[model samples]
Target: MLNTGQNLRPGSQLFSSVSESNHAKGKYYLGNQQDGNLVIYPAGTIDADSSYWSTGTSNRGLLLTLSLDPNGTLWMFDGNTSFTKTLFLTNQSSGAAPAVENYYCLTLDADGVLRLYSHVFLRLEGKPTIKVAWQVPGDRCLVKGVCGPNSFCQLTMTGETSCSCLPGFEFLSTNQSTLGCWRTLPISGCVRSNNSSNEETRMMATMVEVKNTTWPENPYDALPVTTSIEDCKLLCLSDCACQISMFSDSYCSKQMVPIRYGRISGSNNTLFVKVYTYRAIQRKKIAGAGAMLISGATLVVLSLVVLSGSVFLICRHKRSLRYMRAPQLYDCKVDGDIGLQSYSFQDLDVATNGFTQELGRGAYGTVFKGVLANISKEIAVKRLEKMAEEGEREFHREVRAIARTHHRNLLHLLGFCKESMCHLLGYDYMPNGSLANILFNSDVRPSWSKRVAIALDVARGLHYLHEEIQNPIIHCDIKPENILIDRSGIAKIADFGLAKLLIGNQTNTLTGIRGTRGYLAPEWSKNTAITVKVDVYSYGIMLLEIISCKRSMELKRAGSEYNISEWAYECVMFGETKKVADDACIEEAELVRMLKVGIWCTQNMPVMRPAMKSVVMMMEGSKEVRQPPRPASFSQS
Candidate 1:
């Protein structure tokens, strides 16, 4: 069942076996049931136990298909139906679904889990970069009976699990504890019976208390009547079968042999275990007490000597530390819009599999697919080609600003990794990837409606960055490659590497030709103050590409060389507006209106460019947009 893009059509199913990472061993299927609920179950399932997971997508006569987008989005959609779904394997993959489903996978691990993995499959380049987008039992604790009975399991934030034995008990083995713990001290010879005539057989026992520890368990035996700590201790001590006694808020839980235990990281409960004292155990050998005392003193003196020598040697040894990057690092909330998950270089290494799979390449660096193990979250890790301290400072500033942004249209900064000469950034993976992929590479062309929708989504996000935030952000490079789409068909602003943040009320200017060649604003070429209008101009170019599905680099007509903006204007006026657009079903009025806005955004004068806010309203048909004069372009004539 190595399905690349299997369409689980409405009323059909996608099945997988209970073993292996491939569906060949699968007994499970993600089905669109009659009740509108898409469920994962074994074949011939009629009950709840047959299901592993489900999507509640039910309609009387709705049609939908389960697909994985190019950027690793697992989606269920019909574009024409209410049954459309936008599901993410990881929040990083929270962008527009593919225009048409592409390469991705559904893996059924032998560990009894169903997961969705997506790969950016480039047939020509022959690079298949796979990423785990979504998975089941994401939490290690959620696994059934992961720790053996009678042992408490502790789950770390790094996705590692540890098992521990209770006091007076030891694990059956160091590696596995599925069989539970074995008792260290037996109570049969410790507690005395009144009917037993032999007084020498009686032994005194001591209770060892473990503090701030709790195990979550379905108590097979409990004593609600034990209103005090002493009562709970007495109840357990009276019964030799009780291995551990837990007391919390006057409630007592006694676990017998083969206990089911799990450790809560921040618990306040206490577990007390009764064990026979050394004096009690040696009662039968009282005649040799003097000799035993002498031996014990000698052992104590030897132990102190060893402890002192170990500390002296440890102090002389130098230490080197390397952090093991984990998912917990990326879970920090810096501000409202940003969550900075700081990861170790090693974490990124593991996530990207040594950076073997690359999603895309840019002037700054390359981005690869990564998965956070602890939370089972998929993210895109951008590894910079250069890690200068100055660049690192700039990255930090950008992250701070991006984190404060909280809009659906903007790509969020999930986390970052910094170490000696290595700098990486983590972002929610966008399945649709960049707009360039849609307009240039893929055959799954976006319809006129989808193009318009994407234009509006990008507008809204840019509007937030330019107008809503405290400090206006000037995106020096705003192009199709910088615009990312989520599974929901909404677009978002991404790639802040060249983003410039305005400080206070002062208008600060920058130098140098910054953006991609074709989309760079004229102002960038001129020695003048850069403004948010630069982004406005680039966006206009991108908007046109969305409509025409062509690069806006250069266009010529009537044997005269001119820019795309000027060429588009001439075509629209001659009643050839349809010819100016890519082949798609679109109403004449909408096409004309969209074209007019694109023209207005590309106006030669910076003052003529409408703000992103205005762009959004015009695209959404919420504001009246007037027709503009032909946009002037840089002609070589």
Candidate 2:
């Protein structure tokens, strides 16, 4: 029953009878009082009454003429050239044809009744039906002008307004113009409440729950429900500089700085302390009393074990250290002098759960999935299958080399484990498996753009290793199996066991062949001096594979040989480059650009090959492509 100005439309009629209470009728005008003009209707008699005239020509439609009575009877001047009305059951305008007009006026009375008036015609029948509705003009806010306390205002469709607190706050008052809200005090300054005793305050403060809050910056700082108040308090108390403690039944969070925008839920029952006294003596007394009896017996046993083990371990370690520290007599047995953090065998065993989950098997060792116990972070554990001399040398070399290097595109070494017959190296796990899985698997084929991205990622990673680093490293074994993909479809180079670090312009003196077949540089086959170009050639082949989405080698017949790189070379020379491209990458300009780079990298002469730096630049830079020259035996097949 609110008198909202709604549901009123122009061109409506209202009627009243003579029997209506306190009816006063002679001549009454039905028009807006706010306007000076009024239309008169005669109510008492049908005559040319001068009292109804208000200084206007009658022919121009009397501005104040009235000829209707409250008895539902009509009255008007009856003449040939004058306005006239006849008594009828209904009060209807009867006169010369009226001109069509658009203007109308409507008004509401004290009782919320609407009355309408139109210039063209006025008609009223028996008990005219009337309906009312409501409407809003524009948006409104709960706060008159400004927003809530320390809050901003927003308008609703119906013109209603509301408030929102700024960053690092909760709504403290409905009247937002005054004080807004307070932040939880820091743990270093936690104090007992002055309002009431701890017990009474805990009950009241717990009940005064903050409701419907959100942390604008770090949501993790929101108190979780899994942890207890005591546990939450202990966590906050342990960190002397903590600023806030949020706890739920399931979790607890402590912040070291001012808590940001967080809504207090209605159900929160945790206490927020500003600071508390450090009772170290009481804590020490409790700990000392509990451990006194057990400490003696445990210490006695531990001493005897330590005394015996220490002597034996000292001698064994001294011998092993001497052997490892000795000068290397062969190039293959090169010892990397990189100092890395060593992990205890027990630490790694606990991480991998005794190497239970086998991730993959390789010639050197079986890779297993492990978790770092201290951080609770997952990692890949490659446990080397102990062989005579080569495997042990490679294991030590890989750990030392990889641990010394750090790059975004390179896999990270989390830690390592060395046992009598098994050596394990922990690395960050790649969830999406390897590039081989993505390329060859029938279940999922990477889109052309994704393949181009993968190729660029791999190329950039190799370029970093080969050129960007102060001491460039050569990834001796670059192949599809070693190229791992992360969950986001990013490619990273792995398997640094055969990798060698180049200090200055020193070339890696290879004593034996070390690389995958079909991917080995042509110079490596001819016993040419190995350099970073070998890795570049291998990377080029891999790039071609990524662009083509095909294996380096495929069977043409039972006894025939077909190599993808060779076929691609033929296709390029014969001007049928599209035919050699991966069927999946067809019509993709990026793939074509990558293919051009790949061909340039795989040129027969090592010196003619672009440096990995140039390769990366060409892949990323928007430069024009150049036509490559046809080599001898371009289509040997």
Candidate 3:
């Protein structure tokens, strides 16, 4: 009886009291509880308590059922429904009502008891929890046909039970009075009708009318009929599907099922049982119409499938043409004297084995482990993200620089693919991945000397980008993800997709927010014109994060207690930098000096930070260093 809440759905359950589908028309549902209660409620959210109905029978063996009729009425019954309770679900101040468009379910237990539950998606527990709305006890008096047939139960003045037949009816079973009574005139000629006239058929139809009674029972069709009582009776007679018609409160319900009722002397309702001699003939006609409808629907579904398939093929062909044309814009067939080469999509697909063996995914696209056929060299293939004109300009800038720029401390771009809209870039594979992963994820920790060497190499690469080139290039994104390590554990700067080429004295690059969170420079937040100093600030943050093995972004503001940077600065000020150097195995003086230099680079004002050349000099111990003042960002605190 204990089930995960996710299994609850609209019109789904273990056992329903009625053999027919409950909540088939949607909106209403039922759930069987472990406590043996049968409940009926709306689906999707936790019980809104809008207007739910239930058979309040719990912990009573394993029999339960919660059912709903097409017309807003819900029933709670079990295998033994003689004493089961009935509830009408309508919107009111004192009841629960269902919301529109939600998943719901009803369950009947082995004991024949019924309960209703709604499906609620609450993820803190990582599964749904069932909310009970309504339940019904398997009260035996409520079971349909308990009094058997054509007979009603009566309580005598002495509190005894007795069964009696209607005026002209007789008992079907003499020994068992509850087995019900039958009509004095047997229903015949129903199967022998040979297309009789409407007048003759209506004349032969006999109505057994009983007032002050209605059964909370099964239905063949529960819908609005004419206000006139006689019209309601005639409507039931016309439809062969309907055997009995009940009218109460201005609505009519026609049913083919047996009617069961509790003894009531003053209900003021009407229940009519129509006996037609041609009922068997009408049933055959209905069955034939159903077969023809199914055949017509099948043909319509097949035609729609063919039409949709043709449209899909045409759209795919048009898409392929756009992809093929995108690569022709650049002359990719030409080879150059530059170190980098050009590749086609077909050539890369073979290299990466159809883009299999995925290394990982990034913010843009996927990276795969690949191998070149000509050189037989293992490489990393990056499928560049599709972009607009501005991004296309950036892609071209990266390609041109990779072709010309060559440095031992920089990652080598082997080639690029431009055969279609699929853009890819290939780079020499690094045995050791990024510094962040090496420091945080891997078992082999980077030694203090190795950390210092890595820092110097990264600075040299930045120095090459800032001062070495004729027109300096700004590597706007310089987080550890872009720092690749060679087989010898040498750090190399990579991922130049965010590189901006500077011409002459132009340092201002106006654009939207760029770089990742926790690593973005302060200038990005201000929307101010960016300079190489932005890279300096980012490098400073990266350097501090490397030293203490702590995150700079997680640090407190300058005056709000200790962040990694602030802690390192204060430690160095007190001649205790070695304490914050973590488990590094390096000379105390070098650790002290690196800590000082790291803190100085992260100063609030970009102008206060040193250039890449000065950073390299400070790490190499070739230049004099000065103690820094409290950072300007502290003023806010």
Candidate 4:
């Protein structure tokens, strides 16, 4: 009968069929279940057969069958070598009627290639029965290599491996371990020989080869380059005692003193020169002729003087009048109700042991350590270098200025020695040497508190000089080496050679460039006018060095782009304030506070920087800190 919506088939092999009838829905009936093709009415229905069947449940709706290989094995559905079933399959299949199964499951391999197998057949055995074989893609290959010294290599299987040098190199630091090697050494430019044979022979050939590798160890003794190499050689050879000459492309440098560390690298470029034979002979001839002329002239002048005594006396009187009317080289004034006492040259000579003991040597003169036997005390004897005009003026200025000044921080002058051309000033002895020695030595590092104390001491000394002293003294050159520390670690400012007294209300002095290179104030470079602010700038640099445990010049290398001050400035700007503290300092808060004061003193603009008086207060934690302006040129290089 044909129903509204129904279609069915009887038997597993299509033995009965049903179609829709005009009045009733189609129905399906089966005579018996057998192993044959079968269909059910409606799209969703159940079918059964003697050997195989399928349920219409939503979960397991679709099922399939498989035939075994022709190896005397009965036909059975393949279920093994398929899905990896553990407890569920083992327990459920064992209790229930033998589970109807079909084709095996497939899985992805390590290379992501799919593999199919027979689950029922493979599970009956101990191990998997199927095997998979496929080629691995070329992109999946691995790479291995080694990096060479000063060269870094990275492995990349997708492309070629790469090798490169570290920063600050024109090429790879070392030759490649594999292919593509390159040289790292910079190509030597043109090798132009020095024009003067004497200079080349003395500096390049003789002195540099003979002396120790390192030269000019003392920072104070560094020579400045002047004229050409030939001129340099002539200058050195002209002076019989000249020891070394430093030559550059433009000028030749000659040192009439000791070469501290003699080593020179190609990068140094400067030449070291020594005296040659020909120049020595010339100098001797010149000195002989000059001496003979002086002797003959003195004898003739004495004979003329004896013949005309009255006439000579009248001429001498007139000469004296003329000399008295001439302007003095320097003006002098005394303070503190103390009268100036001048001793003869003979008196100082005996007191200083004939100037046998040299306490220190400077650009101006030698300071001899002396003991006044008559006075029963030790004193520093400063013998000024000979001067025709300017030097004498400076000597007199130094004597008058330092003589009247009396402060705990200032070095004390006892007396003075004056003669026709010789001058000497006496001072109290400082047992411990300058601050430079203690700060740079590797053997010991001063405690954090001690460094801060030294800074405060220096500031106080400057404050007194700028404010309390009758004639305000400006310490034009204020470096660590100029600061002397006594046995008790109390710092006293010394070396008043470059000091000048303030005239009237003048805040600045017009003078030639003086003081160390790294410590000079920026204003000094542009204008001749100098103020106490120059010393303040130098003190700032010194304070930064003390806190960071580094030298300003040493920080200019392949690394350390930022100098001690710049580095501290960066830390402050980035809000990483703790980085300013030195590793040796145990007190974090104190170190930061000191660094803040240092930055304030080092501000580029003179108007922005605080005076020594304000700096002292800030160090004592009595003042608040404002943001310091950026430095003009912070580069150490």
Candidate 5:
């Protein structure tokens, strides 16, 4: 008996002979076959071609049942309610529920489709029309056996499915191409015949290459590895039983005749079809010998033109190479901030050798050490790993901000790459490492004068970014990790991944909290507008670390002394400034002066913080260092 408009709960079984019809008396109905495939077939028929939709879950398990839950999701599961494993599911389509309580069913209509429908009971004295809620294998071509063996299926521009015969095969029926295809010539076994040897048979056959196509059939033999596509093709041609072969990523698979489930693909798979050498030659002969003669002349003319152009380009490139070989010209190109180089992702990937040497990781990506063989210059490549749209904007902004500025203290942007989904920035490599290593981890810290000079270097870089440029920029993240030391021990500011640019004459902008904690300005947490002063606060904390060689907020340091700025201020109050200086050859006067400048910069109020320009002067002793009030709310203790 067929039932309609009834919900199938968990453990409800539909046998091979059982079916549920649509409430509107449709000719088609839903049934679960004895082979364990849930299918939709028309009335009084079970032919394979007549059934266009199936769950494809044959041999799932014993005692399987199809259930449609209250949320409108239909699922097929094996076993009983207590121990069930879900095999397949379809998501709910419509948000509206059936007006009749607990009313829904899997229905098959005259259109030859299996669907889940909801009957909305009308308030008036009238019957309710059923709405199609969901259907599987929506396109007819997705149904298996639609296009039989030796043929491929594809969708036309009009969105209709079509079938085509594979190479070296002919359509079984022109009127109904879906009936599939047959090979034009039969192939013999691998056993050597009296007339031909195995090698001779291979020479008589040729492999035709087909790109962007695949057949999902399992291979009879698979080679673990092959050197190239040519090697895979040769192996397939050498085998008498192999009619089709697929090669991808060094792996080759050999398939027998009558390849099934053929379709055009966008993957990297390449299909090779074996055919007789005569047939292959016959196809090529369609172009004719006259066309080949013309093509030969055209190729000779084109080759000469290409050779002449290549000679001119080679000479021109050598001249440019000679000009750029000088250190001064190469440095000038980076320092002038004009005509920046645009590198391709492939070039950078080859330079970095697949980004094997990782230097460090940042918020968005990792930095790698690479050398450009063409220019013979070592560089650090920052490859952004975030492939989202937002990450692309940040990449472009960083490139734009650094490309427009030139300063000795600021890291130079040598080039950039924005290809496909890859984003990378190239800069001159710093062999001396970062300031964080020198301050906190190094065994031998630099002398007092050298440390002061390093502080001045960073201050000058920040000053140039905050005021010296036409459009003022804010280095939102300023910490020891960002300050890199060059071969000359000159500190250069790097990692502008978080830097923000202020529009024409705009000194401040509102933004969410950014920058490392313990270095962040008080205004950041208050949800107020941020300015260059935030960077000053961060630099102040880093400056104290530079002077004392202690982290700003060391959790390991006990007794209210973890915060370096707070502890330094207390030491200064007691006139024991020497206690704050960690270097054995500390210059007491310079330490006091630098510490005072640092204190002023870390003031709780952004208004009280000195600008980066003033900090540079104080570090160089051009401006007098005065007594700074206790850095109020800035304490990290």
Candidate 6:
């Protein structure tokens, strides 16, 4: 196995061994054998069942060595010669490659999974941060023999895979559960017997029903009876040889031990496992007796307490009835799981300190910076000035959509307040303010690297809204003023007042001209149906602004007036792309790549522009950015 301090170099071989580390001993091994193949296996054994992943370079009958590059590329070469043949490779593409000082190594983790890890030294933290650069069988549950036979693999709420034994079964090795499990009680109903003594013992066996679970092992008997789930459960319980029964769509299958390939499934499959019921019966009897004793004592106490509180209860009921009969104030449809709190107008008024400290103003509302009295945490409260234009339903429809969205790059909606016609929204305060403040109004300009990161941040946020969610959202407005920077220097997309959600099977909507003039797509002026590409066009315009640190409409060079998109096209055409973002420290290739992406996005036609997903890939250097065609002379509609 590879060690913590060592990285696999060219012509090096890895042997299976136990090392002192945080991992459990004797569960994993990585071997770059004499053959060309590089494989991972369960420690102490090498078999079809124990092996999980390999480079698939084996069977070539040539000696191969594994090597990891600084860019997180893993490849194998044949023999130790200048003219070496490459066999297998995997690449991890990111914004930039890791530094030479960073430690990169491949390890067969304790969980029987293979991973390429990079330990980069953080200068400010004075310690190295470990990151997983690559991994095989990305879903850990897919690793063969990870949980072994008679046990199921499950993904917990925390996103980790765990092994769980079937009902009435226990782990064979508690310390290392991957070894599998065994039945706690001896098998009794394997063979049918007519003896009366055995009949009662068989009746004692009960079926434990579980939903959304499957054991894909071949069944000894498959019954295609179109019966209900209850009937299937009873059939498995009465069978002499059946250990587990799987039922789906009225089909029943009987499986014998040891059952293999059990996992939590998304389908509506029910698993019924036969378990020893003696212990369960005893526990239920004890619990029932205790419940009866407690109920008898509680009843006497409740009788006395009720007599004393009768008068108080009547008075409280009358008071509540009077309040319930009073006039209703407001009504707003809200989803319980939207992750937004419904605050009264009075509460927001107090939270914003009577709307005194103005943070900023937008097309829909004015934002105020305030510290919540209850939590003593700062918040940005936007009091919608034009709430009267759009009724309560429209305001809440936007709120519900915004609250349902969650991404690291997207702004989080904390809560909302509605009082009759008054409407307001609360958000986590962004201490660094909007991108407009940092770009045009600040004394010091941000570095090229930070600008590139911010552009990517906005692209990812837009991608989440456009493609990642169930109902795609078009952020009609994409501008610097709407992109806010948090305290940690991360940019978040905000202001969803003009955001439009495409309902089921609805790709485009006919809406009036929306968004700032310079950022709007040509479709807006043409009075055509609006799609997500409009946001892409706006993002493209903003991308150029982020690179040049200049506004789109106000861009000029050496006293010559030019649109920012037009100026960028001219720079790229004349082999002067360096002028777009002239930073001495940044790579020219990355700079040119971003310029091309921006140009492609700003194409006049909606179909000509690349989607946000493609833009993000090109900006992150994962996808090659080809040369873009010339944008229309009129960049904005």
Ten residues in sequence with the least summed lDDT for candidate 3: 42-51
Model 4 lDDT, residue 68, Cα: 20
Q: Output the TM-score of candidate 2.
A: 0.44
Poorest lDDT segment (10 consecutive residues) of candidate 1 = 497-506
Model 2 stretches with alpha carbons more than 4 Å out: 1-341, 385-400, 500-506, 555-559, 573-575, 582-589, 631-637
Quote model 5's TM-score.
0.45
Q: Model 3 residue 72 lDDT?
A: 30
Ranking of candidates on lDDT, top first: 6, 5, 1, 3, 2, 4
Please provide, for model 1 over 250-288, each residue's C-alpha lDDT reduced to its tens digit, 9 standing for 90 to 100.
Answer: 788885444443554466787777766332233334358
Worst 10 residues of 6 by lDDT: 277-286
**Tens digits of per-residue lDDT for model 4, 1-637:** 1111222222221111222123222222212112222222211112121111222221221222222222211121213323221111222233433433323332222221222333334334455444322111122211111222222344366544454432222233234342212223211111222334333321221233222222322121224455665666555544433445655456454543212112222334454444222121112232587889997899999988887997888888777776663334233333323445566677778888888988777545688887778878777787766333444455555566676555556776777765555667777777777777777865787777777788888887887676444345777777777778876888888865333421222245554566676777776666646667777888898888877666666665466554556667777777675655545435666666777777777766554466776787778876665455456565322
Per-prediction TM-score to the true structure, in the order listed = 0.46, 0.44, 0.46, 0.45, 0.45, 0.52
lDDT of 2 by residue, 44-123 (tens): 11112211222132333322222333322333342334654432233344553354222233332221122333233324
Off by over 4 Å in 4: 1-336, 339-341, 386-398, 501-511, 557-562, 574-585, 634-637
Clashing pairs in 6: 1-15
Whole-model lDDT per candidate: 0.66, 0.52, 0.61, 0.51, 0.69, 0.73
Model number with the top lDDT: 6
Model 3, TM vs. native:
0.46
Number of the predicted model whose TM-score against the real structure is largest: 6
C-alpha lDDT of residue 521 in model 2: 74
Rate residue 420 of model 4 by lDDT.
Answer: 55
User: Residue 426 lDDT in model 2?
Assistant: 74
Positional deviation of 74 in candidate 5, in angstroms? 84
Tens-digit lDDT track for model 6 on 1-637?
4434444543243443244465345556666644455666654333333456777765555666666665555666565544343322434346443442365777666666677777777555667889877777777776666787788898888878899988889988889786677778655344332234313333257788878776653465777678778888878777876878888888888876667657776879988988864321122232587889998899999998998799889888777776652323236548764667888888888887799999988776799987889889899998776433544566677678788777789888889887766778889999999999989999998999899999999998897787555456777888999999999999999985344421221245565566787898888777577888888989999999999888887875687556677788889889897777777887878878889989988877775577776787789886777667688866453
